[model samples]
Target: MKKWAIYVVLCILTPAIVKAQAVVADSVHMTSKKKVPKVQYGVASFYHNKFEGRKTANGEIFSQKKLTAACNTLPLNCWVRVTNIRNNRSVILRITDRMHPLNKRLIDLSHAAAKTLGYTGHGLTRVKVEYLGKTKPVELNLMEQPAQP
Candidate 1:
């Protein structure tokens, strides 16, 4: 009878024990706030082909087709406008990961962004990046306004 009672108690307490362990594990991954720079100018590069499916710093799967970029210190999930200073082409990308610590570039672009900016051939480009804050609705001037009295 005592063995049966102990087994019941163990079953009742197991879920709470597992939940507490989960909380502890998640706490270790918490990231502190990071400030985004208004504008930055430097050499930019792209994510290499080997890291296509790896996990990014923000916990998302890396996808070269997405308009994403990486920075050393910018806040995750924020958007930035990257312009190729050579051809004056620009594209907006989200900060979804971090650049390699040993990398000396200012920002790392996604493969698609590099291709769109006409830098895939060179693998690196001189670029200007402007922080656009977090993703938000973009207002368009072409929308028809209400008629005024």
Candidate 2:
């Protein structure tokens, strides 16, 4: 009877011990690397009319004409600088919404913001973005990264 009890206790404790070990390993992996956020450049299109006036992830109604953008990991009410390399033009947009659920792009700009960069169709454009290190009320200004060929 004592041996049976011991075996049962071991079976119960083993999983908990293993789980603790896994948690420690995961913590080590997360802490060992510096998390530098990399900005991605790609072909992005704006959403308007359909999504305008609708509630955004930031709990504000989306506006197609606003100088605003949606980002995945950027905190709400941070500013981001989006630049178009082809024309050397850029727009400073407040991060007023979260990223699109199905997209891997860094940001989703409003229609007016996209127009600032002269993007009309789906094609690759050189872009550089930097997160403004502030929170609400957002300061929509950031230094633009030099265009990469």
Highest TM-score model number = 1
TM-score of each: 0.69, 0.60
Compared with the true structure, model 1 gives a TM-score of: 0.69
Report the error of model 1 at residue 87, Å. Answer: 0.4
**Model 1 C-alpha lDDT per residue in residues 1-149, reported as the tens digit of each score:** 99999999999999999999988878865653445579989999998899999999999999999989999867889888889999999988789998879989999999999998999999889999988887642631223356669
lDDT tens digits, residue span 34-86, model 2: 44354646555566568888998778899888888887666678767788878
CA RMSD (A), model 2 = 8.6
